[model samples]
Target: MEINFKGKRALVTGASKGIGRDLVIQLVKCGAEVVAVARSRELLENLKKEVPSIEIVPLDISDWKKTKEALNKQGPIDLLVNNAGLAILGPLTEVSEENVDELFSINVKSIINISQWMAKQLISRKAPGSIVNVSSQASMAGLENHSVYCATKGAVDAFTRAACTELGPHGIRINAVNPTVIMTAMGKIGWSDPKVAAPMMAKIPLKRFGEVHEVVDAILYLLSDKASMINGVCLPIDGGFTAT
Candidate 1:
């Protein structure tokens, strides 16, 4: 199905690279005015060059005070994609307080903060809106050395549900997308070794990692009016990995 976002406005965090960057481009192609947020002004500037009409908001979404101010300045947004996250992998035995704090600050705290900001805007305006939080399969499955990352994503999924409960009454829908390893730069490097990838690959019915567009397609559908009835669902785009 062809989904359109004409006359809508979207705010996508982590818009500098990987799935976030591509999502920004696709949202624009679907005719939505977009505000792309990321830490790297230089990279965001380059993205602006490619998609000239998109507005860029350069900030670290983990900064609670500044994030609120930055998002408030955006006026009104019709769609929100809380795609910014950090993954610091380590075993439970090796995890440190600093690592845990940083991961939760970026991955969990940022999502809650931004989603609240977006929901308020939509609620105050009495506008119906959609929010897609970019969570991960790690939230549901246990990986060998991703204890902290998994914890953060788990929190994200729980928060998505809770937020939906409150926001649904305000005509705001909130959901999450948990994707398997996609072939982004980070995915290619982390899973490059056959030994590392084989165990995970064996579990997937499709026996392959996901591509960027596959996840993006799922997200776009959730963000559009096509998924109006879908709320508080943590949809997995894991090539049937979760199924196995």
Candidate 2:
């Protein structure tokens, strides 16, 4: 089905690269006015070069005050993608406090702050809107060395459900997309070693990492009218890994 988002306004975080970048492109292609947020000014500029219609907002989501101010100025967002996250791979005991703080700040806290801002705007206007938080399959099941990462995503999954319940009456739908290992530049850099990739692949029923487009497609579905009845849901795109 052709999902048309003509005249809709979308704010996508972490839009500099990976699945977030593809989301911005696809949203723009569907005729939505997309405000792409990222910390990399040069990459944002390049993305704007490629898709001149996309509005580039270069700000770190971890800066809650700045993010709130920016969203207030933008006003009446139709869709919000809380896609900004950080991954620190290590045992919980081995992980530094700094890394743990960064993970929660970016992945968990930022989502709450941004969604609160967006929720207020939507509630005040009574506007119909949707929120898609990019979580992970790790949230569904724990791994050997992903305790901190799993904790952060577990927060995301919980937040999505609770937020949906609170925001649903205001005509806002909140949901999350939980993806397994995706083949992105960051993934390549982090899991390039077979030692890391081998055990991960073995758990997947499909025995392969998901592509960027697969996750983007899921995000677009949840944001569009097609998923009008779908809310407070965590849809897993995990290549059947979570099934077991």
Candidate 3:
């Protein structure tokens, strides 16, 4: 059966660019009323010009009080994609405490704070919806210089599982999508060198890093009722790389 969300309202964080931006576009096409959240007001304004009907909320998700305020003002939404994240890679021993705090604030804490507010909204309204957290393959395996990012994402997946258990009875499902070497604009720059990408690609059965749409598609599935029975799972969209 085909997936559809014609009248659903979706709140997508990190929506200014990359997979988040593309996801917003796709959701709009699928007829969902999208509330796009990100820190880039210019980019969001541009996106609004393209999709005039979309709602835009530009705020840093790292600030707990402000993030909570923004979400509370958003009224109600049917789905949430926690895609905002940051990575400051270096050797584990050399990583700064500041970096660790920053990464955790955005990549980890943001999800919990936002989801908590969403949970209250859902529970109060007695509504049912889905939440998709955009995690990374780094969460599953160790990568050089990615120590902090990995830890944060790992924590995110753990929270997804635990949150699913508590929120499931409330009819709010939560899951995480772990992608590998995606081909977003930022990704292209990070993986631009064949020397850098070749080795990572070799580990994947598909022999290629993933494209943004592949991830977008996976997230859309999990967000839709098509994945109604799928909850509390950390789905690896890694081109079978994790199979190795």
Candidate 4:
């Protein structure tokens, strides 16, 4: 289907690179006025050169106090994509307190804080809106070294479900997209070793990693009115990896 978000206002976190950057560009292509947010001002400025129409918000979403202020300044939005996350991979036993704290602070806490703010804004304005949190397939099942990352994403999944219940009456739809091994720069380096990636790919029926745009397509679908009835669902763009 041809999706057009003409005249919509969107707030996208983690908008500097990877899937987040792709979303900002694609959302603009669909005609939405997107506020691209990330910690890197330099990268965001370069992104602006490519899609100058998008508004750039240069702030770290993991900073609780500043994040609240930054988001509040945005006023109101029709679409919110919570794509900012930190992935620190290690075994559960070997995980340090710092690793756990930093990961949760960025991945879990940020989602709740922003979603709460957006939900309130939507309710106050008496308007309907959609929220798509970029989670991971690791949340569905454990990976070899993604213990903490998995935990945070799993929390994200649970939060999305409960948030939808409370916000449903307020005309806010909250959902998550869990994608596996997307072919971003990090993905390539992380999975470049055949020994490390072979077993993971074997599990996926398609035997290939997802492209960035495919995940972006899912995010846009959830944000669009086309997914009106799809609420609180953690849709997996895993190439059937989770099927087995």
Candidate 5:
């Protein structure tokens, strides 16, 4: 189905690269005004050079106070994508306290903060909106060395379900897309070795990692009116890996 976002205003975090960057470009192409947020000002500027119409917000969403202030200043947002995240991989027994804190700050806490802000904005305006939180397969199935990452995304899915009960009353929808290893710059680095990637690939029925656009298409659909009735779902874009 062709998804359209014309006349919509969207807020997308992690807009500097991977799935978030592509989402911004696609949203603009579909005639939505987009506010792109990321910590790397230089990368955001580069993205702006490519998509001149996008508005970039160079701030770390982990800082709850500043993130709230920045988001409050934006105009009415019809859609929100909580896409900013960090992954600190290590054996569970070897995980550091600092790493856990950093992971939760960005992956879990930032999402809650941003989602609350978006929900309140939509609520006060008496507007109906959609929120798509970018999550991961790690949340469902245990992956070696992904203990902290899994914990964060698991929190996101739980929050999505719980928040939907509150947001639904106001005609707002919230959902999450848990994607498998998409072949972005980071994904390539993480699974570059055939030995490392083979085991995971074997688990997927498709026998391959996902592409960035594949995940982007799913997010855009969830964000668009096409998914108006779809709420509080942790949809998997994992090539049936989780199903297995």
Candidate 6:
């Protein structure tokens, strides 16, 4: 079935750049009213310049209280894309406690807070909606220097499943899209040197890095009516990286 988001209101976190930006553009293109959230006002402004139809909300997801207040002011959101996250790469032994806490707070806890808020609002209104958490393939396997990041995404995967079970009866579906490294600005920074890129590319059967639209396409499908029966599962858009 052809996917369309006409009459839907979507809120996308981390929408200033990378996969989040692509998602906002795609959602708007498909006729959805989008509220784009990001911490960077400059980047958000630039995004609006590119796509004037987007409604920009500049706020950090790490600030739970402020995020909740901001979201409460927005009325009802039909789709919540919890895509804000960070990766502070380092061996577990060397990673500071503060960094570990930040990783969990931003990557895991914020998702729960936002999803909970959105789910409650939608359920109270008896609105049918979707929640898509942007997780990582790192949640599926361990990697050197990625222990804490992995743990946070693992929590996200589990939370998505558990949240779906509770919210499904209320007509609110929750799912996650776990992707391997995509060629975004953050990905470029991580793979700037051939030494880093070679090993990463070798692992993927696709042999090349993923494109932003590829990930956004999967997200769009999950958010659309096309995935009406799909819920509580993490779909890996990793180009077979997790398979091998």
Clashes of 4: 0
Candidate number that wins on TM-score, 1 or 2: 1
What is candidate 4's TM-score against the reference?
0.98
Q: Estimate each model's TM-score.
A: 0.98, 0.97, 0.98, 0.98, 0.98, 0.97
lDDT of 5 by residue, 90-179 (tens): 899998899999999999999999999998889999999999999999999999989889999999999999999999999999999999
Candidate 3 lDDT by residue in tens digits, 6-98: 878999999999999999999998889999999999999999999998999999999999998888888788899999989898898998889
How much is the lDDT of residue 12 in candidate 3?
96
Candidate 1 lDDT over 55-143, as tens digits, reads 99999887999999998888899999999989888778999999999999999999989988898789889999999999999989998
Which ranges in model 3 have alpha carbons more than 4 Å from their true place? none
Model 5 lDDT, residue 69, Cα: 92
Candidate 6, run of 10 with poorest lDDT:
1-10
Candidate 5 C-alpha error for residue 2, in Å: 2.4
lDDT computed for candidate 5: 0.94
Clashes per model (N, Cα, C within 3 A)? 0, 0, 0, 0, 0, 0
Residue pairs in clash, model 4: none
Total backbone collisions, model 6 = 0
lDDT of 4 by residue, 98-171 (tens): 99999999999999999998988899999999999999999999888888999999999999999999999988
The residue-by-residue lDDT of candidate 2 on 1-244, one tens digit each, is 9999998999999999999999999999998999999999999999999999988889988988898888777856899999998988887779999998999999999999999988988888879999999999989998888899999999999999999999999889999999998988987887789997999899999998999999999999999999999999999999999998
| Candidate 2, superposed: residue stretches over 4 Å from native | none
